[model samples]
Target: MRIYVNEIKITDDSIKCYTEESTEGLQEAGQMLVDSDNYSFAYILDNGQSYSYLIFVQETWSMLHENKGKKIIINDNLELEQFESEFNYILDNIQGNLNYGKEFVSVVEDTFELE
Candidate 1:
């Protein structure tokens, strides 16, 4: 959904960044995006710093799917009430969607941080 780069908010739809060395060494990884349209809607990353891919998707799902079940550093300060409301909204709205996986709705709180 949202990634903080040096504490700057970066959403999934943001533009991509890359380093010079990656141009050749990561040719296959580069091709991974160029060759597939489905994945084009997203970016694949291996957890490096600075230069990385910018997945093309909505903020929340991208973050949820990308970092599923993984421990990530989130904002140290956040609003608990607002977070719970948003999480509940997502769960209630998308809960019955089998394509998105019914499990996803229940998993909202697991993917976010609320101080």
Candidate 2:
């Protein structure tokens, strides 16, 4: 599966994920990823101003996973078409609920300087 972070796309190569059949299973998978130190996960979040591309790498997953439903703001945007394509791809490939409301891919928002 793929995820859009602003204009950038991230795929499975850079991340390790688990697809579960139920929300409970999904939560368990997320918890497993969070407890481990060798995996990372990505999510897309919007906080009014822009969408945030957040990633949890190595040991960082635990902290983020603790506040599961909270919104953390990061500056980013994504193309609707690309996001949809990736979303569909995940549904097609994974045999589960797969609708955790987060993208399977991850990207960092670009920083710009005003002239």
User: Evaluated with TM-score, which candidate comes out highest?
Assistant: 1
What RMSD, rounded to one decimal, does every model reach? 13.6, 17.8
Assess the local accuracy of residue 51 in candidate 2 as a C-alpha lDDT between 0 and 100: 43
Task: Report lDDT (CA) for all predictions.
Answer: 0.32, 0.28
lDDT tens readout by residue for model 1, 1-115: 2222222233443312322222222111221121122322223333343334433333344444454333222232221123223333544444444455434433433433311
Give TM-scores for every candidate, taking all chains together and pairing residue i with residue i.
Answer: 0.25, 0.24
Model 1 accuracy (lDDT, Cα): 0.32
- Residue 43's C-alpha lDDT in candidate 2? 48
lDDT of 2 by residue, 9-57 (tens): 2232222222221112111111111111223444443444444333445
Displacement of the residue 57 alpha carbon in candidate 2, Å:
0.2
Q: Please list all clashing residue pairs in model 1, or write none if there are none.
A: 1-59, 1-63
Winning model by lDDT: 1
